[model samples]
Target: MLSYATIGVTDLNKSEAFYTELLAPIGAKTLMKMDRIIFIGKSMKEPMLAICIPFNKEEQHCGNGNMIAIAPGSIEKCDELYNKAIELGATCDGAPGQRIPDLFYGAYFRDFDGNKIAFNHFG
Candidate 1:
């Protein structure tokens, strides 16, 4: 139902570098780039994540209750991706673990620009 999700950022180049490397494990790369935005994903046909400067020309800030959830297909992969996010300088929102006993394994972190992301696996 979603084509892409955009996260506002202050530095386009820095955010682009951060996301491109962090998501590389999932086969996501920079599919497209514009002056103020870069789209990253496995393909344009799949859901993509966009990091960009605000169109309104104001300062970029994260919303109070917004997050992007990604399914890595397994608990172990989720853990690996979560650790990669940390290695890329993201701050932890939650550590990797089962969130709903046997049903959900997930981890959360905020990127350099404070955009929240979840590496999740559902059984």
Candidate 2:
């Protein structure tokens, strides 16, 4: 339904570092991008991280207010991914847990640039 998904950020390097470690075990990585943009998702040739060159003071925070949700396979995998994201330094926006009893298990995190990112496991 879409070509790709992008999350904005403030620091490319910090975001890159965080993403590299977080996405590694999941098979996601920095694909391609300009200095002001860092694409970290699945390939190093695509830009999934649309980070801000510098901290934008006028920018609002990252949240459902403006965020993307990625659903992996199982709740356990979701938990692992969420843990990896945090271990790499992404801020915890929402912790990994049952979002809806027996319905959805997911977790949320804020990237280095403060973009809201989430992982959901529905199966």
Candidate 3:
């Protein structure tokens, strides 16, 4: 139902670096770039996640109930990505673990721009 999602960032370069590392484990790469935006995806033809400066020219801010979730293949991968995120300056919102035993295993963190993101695996 969703074609793509975009997150607002104040610093493109900094947000780019943060996302590059964060999305690597999930196999998403920088698929394209423009003056103030970067698109990420597993392939050029797939749905993308974009990071951009607000088009209205206002300061960027995270939304109260917005989040982006990624499935990185396994619970272990979820943990790995979560660790890598913290190493790259992300703040932990939740550590990697099973939130619903045998059903959901995930980790949550806030990106450099304070956008909430999650890495998870489900059985």
Cα TM-score per model = 0.97, 0.76, 0.93
Tens digit of lDDT per residue, candidate 1, span 1-123? 889999999999988888888889889999999998899999999999999999999999899999999887789889998998899899999999998998998899999888999999998
lDDT of each: 0.92, 0.71, 0.88
- Give lDDT tens digits, candidate 2, residues 22-122: 76766777676686666667654543544445445555355558777776667877888898888777789888888788788879987766788888987
- State the local distance difference test value for candidate 3: 0.88
Winner by TM-score between candidate 3 and candidate 1: 1
- Top model by TM-score, which number? 1
RMSD of 1: 0.8
Whose lDDT is greatest here?
1
- Candidate 1 global TM-score: 0.97
lDDT comparison, 1 vs 2, better candidate: 1
